[model samples]
Target: MGRNTRKRRTPLATKIVAGAAALAVGGGGLVWANFYASAHEEHGGHNRTRSAAAQVATIDCPDVGQQIRDVPDRARGEVDGELATMDSQITDAYQRLATTRRAQAGDAQFVGNSILGPLKERRKVIIDRIQLEINRAGGRADDNLDELAGCQGRPADQMQNGGGQNGDGGDQNGGDGQNGGGGQNDDGQNGGGQNQDDNGNGVAGPVADDFIDINDVQPNSRNSRNGLAANGDGGSTGTFTTECGVNENNLFNSDNLIAAPGVDNGAHHTHDYVGNQDNDAFSSDQDLAAADTSCQNQGDKSTYYWPVLRLQDGTQEFDAGDQGGGAEGNIGKILKPAQAEIKFVGSRQGDVVAMPKFLRVITGDAKSFTNGDANANSSWSCSGFEDRQVTDKYPLCPEGSQVLRTINFQSCWDGQNIDSANHRDHMAFVQEDGSCANGFQAVPQLQIRLAYDIPAPTVENGQVQNPYAVDSFPEQLHKPITDHNDFINVMDEDLMNEVVDCINRGEDCQ
Candidate 1:
């Protein structure tokens, strides 16, 4: 089926301006780096450039949720709630930093004194509560949690200089000269940061420098576990395709049932859901099992969702004034996917077993911009250029090609638990040789492919118009690297067995 070309929302020619300066503060330390703004000539003075160390683009806090190694099952709920609160606290602090450009420029210690300081204190309280919960539940909370409380004002340029991997200058974005546009890419991602001329547009970024022409990128090779191509013919090669309409029912929310189950707006960004009908932050296992589904097979009531992609053409969505929408900096018209493909396929090494019911898996990192690409697994490309994928940058497709976002869930699973303290420990990707390490068992991997018919954004004279970005936390700045997907297996035993059978037998089944 072809994408609907009719315009759902008209594109607007919006313009953005740049700021004169930027500030940065390192986490747990009082380090400041100012960005060199445009130079000016004083009265009878030479054109003196404003010297600066670097530009602090956003707040970089330790992901406390991912660091906690142990939490008793009884206390998991309380700990999760407190962790979600920490996320909200950071969002609040980031909002202050992003909006108070004038004040930040005036006071050298404004960010430290007013924003980060208060944020750290609030986080400390939350951490204390979290520690108490764990200790009360007989689980020893790590003493190191205190170290994760303080956050730094990370420099935008330093992030790009690090090449989208670890902040230690690792090349997770594929550093080969053919695709590595570190210099140009840096300008693209931070160009808008440097040009924080307005409060409205810069709040959600993919500035002119954040996108590159798809043609300019080289086709990179990707291999799945078991030493086979992602779709290679091998041991367990069959697939089960579930037809879930492209969110036609309009199921949307900002709550994350897997990571922050009971916390409202835990994601802090609107998500488009296409599988289970009754999914929200407060949903329980019984609730999901009994709920209706959008999938073609009623037995397959699994939940699948991701951040809604939006066009920055100045359209005010229904949530425009709401917390996870415009108010938190995610403004623009939401674009329903023209195509949403959900499939579960077998591992390359051998037949797969049924995934534990209610198994939750999250692929990619929503905070990859500040958290680094350790868990980032975003694949962005255009229709015709599917061979080329970029993890950190959005692709600028040529005419006639639609934008595509692909997410492959972790393919290996620990034999026991369906959930974990960090929500990720139970799941693991296959090792380099395509085999599960540490006694982990292989399960059918879920893959989601979504295509969007968005008007390609254009960059002219260092300014972008009609840029498209996924809805994200305010501090993330809407970078494509932050694109992610989530899934929860709720398939009944009979259907799950069928899926496993099909994959192991090398038969494509629906």
Candidate 2:
């Protein structure tokens, strides 16, 4: 998912007008008149006093600052505690709403009436209580407290319009909300539905017809391929060892999973998260190292994640129904992955080494919706059976078979920068022949395989119907198979050392 480079900027005059209208509606005509006069004076190069007055009038809750100041010293702690609790509750509600929004699919009105409506009402009550307390302490409170509370009236549409209620700037439902098109990032890079070179140049690749031949992938001759080690030997051999870690059935949410460093909520879509429980856009090495872990090994604190794949049934899990007023589509409802397997595949010929901490890397392309930009590395197969592969169309799995989505990230690191401008420059995909490129260091390769228990696509009149479509991806994406993966290493030093030693010893440990 990409951030929208073009911002929807509300002009200063428009903001002023909206504020004035809100005031008038609240029977604060005198306040609006005073604000209008002060704004005009400031525009005419009036005194600083007029500018200050204009600024105060623009505050969402005009008297909040004064109310805080006027609170009696004896009750200040209690007020602070209540305010803190209110903020926490609101944060929790938003998180829950986001989860529900992604888990269930329906029209915007149904979603609003069922999920967002109750949350909004509860928030209103809290806001009213806060306002009453403020007034009781000799402070004026805004009449329209609901607006100040920022409770979303229509969350489904808003989430698709621009990355949900938090305004993370990424489209949760994928592109710009028009035919599931791509959105541009701040660097002029198109996010989702397209592929570009390292320099951001669009390069068209080979297009698959209805389906890709499973024979395209090279074959591996490894057995005992079950549980966490289902994807090849993981760079292990007679004298070299590789360690595997599995994080099973972790909760995946609709929160942003990737953004430029320091940018929070940059991913506008849903992603399954594993390892670090606190992984987010602002996550740092320190933050991740201190976070809780879902992995069996407590010392493995790295964050692993990828976009979610939904079943696309009419049930709540697959339904991105129409928003009220006729906006129809499955925008935010991305199904949680059934399971994820993580492993470190070291070079069979070299000394096993620890992966750099906080190493940021991305695999595949989230924007790869069209044939021109679809990731060559992206692969789809069937669970329990690797011989079956499908591309561009959903595979009609036999009864009892499940779908499998696998992504193998580049194992060669630049040995200097943890990340690059394009998020791919710092790492290079291992050559098809399985050799690291020049100038890149070979570290234990990180590979992720996700499984989903989804039924085969419905067919009518000899044609397959795509009910499990990715709402934010272009229709050309084909059955919503827009797959990508992200990794951030936060393993403790001792644990990394242990992993290195195990790999060097050529032991296959899980």
Candidate 3:
């Protein structure tokens, strides 16, 4: 509600402790072994025998906890303070990368090399120093360094021997690491098998078959078509319309979309962003209010961003911790759609009303990596007047049609809080039958439609290779259908009044 003034703390130690607790409480030795094996392999080290032995024999919970306890409290505090500062620096670097201008061919690379690269190196050094201090205080240095540092050990020297290789020491298809290339199913499709249309055209991809189908899925039960307005008389009728044409001038990639509130770049995965000039972990209300905008309605300084949809060509590259490629070292090369169609549709339940400003809401949970998670609200279809839709995978557009990713946000507001603890409680989706919940007030519903001209995933050597996929950090849990968005209204008072008037009068002014 008020400005966030709390100091930031690094969660590495806590994560390690929680993990150790899980291992202890669950007595899941096999699970721990599997996790260690996975982590070991992810570093690209082949000497799994030695690594596994070291992991099991070198340190146990009692040993680590005692070692941690043995450290002089003052020293531990100093290390934490230093780590927090380093974390802040790293976050700032990523924010810089997200907001930097990418006007030239190599601009993305420059940002990676000049900003993210140095910060990552510095972070490695700090993490190493912390590990050494913990070891000096009687803890095994390697026991939890990876978790504590929030990074895999630097790839073996042999992996880095080739200078021009991608940063994670993986190939163009992403390395064989745990976070890479494992998204495909047995059929080689990303999520599900491709489907053929009635004409026998193999035009449907995993997303279409699994997640959404434009032909079957409706925006809401009441408004099945794209341009149709909401129905009902008890505040179901939309009064005013405003469209913001958001251009992708520059791109943003960061992990800080949902979890970390004020900390910039806190997400473990990368997200592509557009709209507001400043849209990272550190972005504050004041900063957003002051930042320039890419929307045609310059007065509406709202931020709209989502994970980048990557063209899965061999050229895609990933940064550290990113599961798939795209939006890592190459920022500018990722093409932007001609324009993003952002529309606000509100129902006039009562008198003309100006919606609250700075209302924050998130649609489609990014953490819903598993299929059938109630939060998975992603939808995909084809453009160019074609009719096909799918969920959980990319759509196979017909010839001459483009790909479309549509995300719709909840429109019923609690009419009080601008944000809730979960960033969602203040808002609820319109009912499946298209009525606002009883206690919630109907606000302008926000929907975003992104169009891309890309081909469908194809099978190569028994494995489906997608030329395009959604960019995700950390894991290829599902097809890039993990879509989410954010908005902050910065309209002038007069404009707000006009919007309320337009809506109350049942007029659609686009």
Candidate 4:
């Protein structure tokens, strides 16, 4: 199975255009050959397993431009509701824990590590409620494509029709076995039959007989990527062999192997674009798993139960109980809207806070009172404050109406800072475009109040009096970044390649 072939076959581009079925006539076995080759060897030395998303993605298809508008069209609205619930719940839980640990502000700890226990526990209680819609959006489409793969390409179907897998016993690329006579290279794709290079690598050759049939691709790409051609029924199942092959540069490397069918699509979504860490639910990549690295008790932990949204009106949305949103529950229609983000708790110095990525938008969805202790704040009191402040000065409201705050850029961080540090105080507001809206007397503070309460983990002597870095709070943070990025490189490459393969195959993918 590891035998790398330098055999010549057909041009892939031509085969794709001709249709998935055209290649299956005698190509079904070729598909299997590939599958069999990679069954072992670290996915048999290949990288990632192609997801249905890659198989169905259409990159430069002529018809893509024609149907651009109607694209998946599934509104992200429902997902927002779900996000809001998850964001705030986690925040509140953290705050609850943060209060008890208020004593230890000097110990270093990670925001992510603190929440691991709580988040996992909460997820167990009601994962369906919080992540249902988002997960559905992310994984359901992929699942459908798998089903389609089974029915579309492979000699399995030919065998059912009384035809043997061995079309005509020939060399690995000469043809299938049986029926012998060194077949005619059918569609004239080979122009002459399977050709081999001096090094025994199949570079430019005729397309293998197997290709996804037109009927294989799901008519509704959204209904699940179930493509008939993807399924190895009578379609071609060629052998997948990875051996030395050089790129256009002509720099040959013997170990440069040929990957398995759909392998690139699965593991290399970003090979040619992205990366993965699905089990954690919060982790999409290694760097994921919302964290606050500078908090006292510097452990790699996350403490929030579930990230949720808290409205200015005191109303809140969380996911920890019965999880059943379907298409319109926690996510579908939140009778009311709540601001949201992946919440964090526990501080080192001041009261200001920062959120990961684009979370500020969720928190600023609706405005309210400043100084009212986020837990004590209500959605209603936050009413007109959608544009107000949250710190000591410069609030949008008249004097005493509420506290004014700001989100100033940090000299040490990349995103807007909201940590209870020396520079920026509390975040004033969240702008519509994912920017902090803390109107101010100075530069706009770039921090975000992304959490309600996050309890600091454990402490040695005792809880540090202040966690925020005020003159009183000292920076005790110390530890190495445990989550290394290297582990995900292969996975990332696999995901990207999957996307590219889908495009080349002319499937409707993201």
Tens digit of lDDT per residue, candidate 1, span 1-510?
A: 111111111121111111222232212111112122322222211112221234445777778888787899999988888887778777766656665555555555566667666677778888888899999999999886776666667544344322232223221121111221112212333342365422225444655556777876778743322112333467699999999889888887777888887766778888998889888777789988999899999999999999999887667677665567666767778999999999888877787888999999988889888887678788889998988888767888888899999887888899999989998898888775567788899999888899999878876544467888898887787778789999999999999999999988889999
Query: Candidate 3 lDDT, tens digit per residue, 60-135?
Result: 0010111123334334543543444453443334333222222112231343345433544555676577667766
- Pairwise TM-score winner, candidates 1 and 2: 1
lDDT top scorer: 1
TM value for model 3: 0.54
Model 4 per-residue lDDT tens digits across residues 290-321: 33221122232221111121111111122111
Model 1: residue 278 alpha-carbon error in angstroms: 0.4
The 10-residue segment of model 1 with minimum total lDDT is 9-18
In order, candidate lDDTs are 0.70, 0.41, 0.43, 0.19
Reference-based lDDT, residue 293, model 3:
74
Off by over 4 Å in 4: 1-78, 102-117, 120-510
For model 4, what is the alpha-carbon lDDT of residue 93? 31
lDDT of 2 by residue, 1-510 (tens): 221122222221011010111111111111111111111112121111112111111101111111233444333333433443333333333223222322222332332344344544555676576667767866665575455342322211011211122223212221122211111111222121122211110101111122222334334422111112212354543122222233343444333333323322233344566777776544556767898887778888777876655443323332121110001112323555566666676664465456788887776554333222223345577665575444333444556776677666777778887755335666776655455678787677776666666655543322233434332222112223345677888888887877777666677666
lDDT sort, best first: 1, 3, 2, 4
For candidate 1, the TM-score is 0.83
Q: Once superposed on the true structure, which residue ranges of model 2 sit more than 4 Å away at CA?
A: 1-257, 261-265, 317-334, 371-375, 462-466, 469-481
RMSD of 1: 10.7
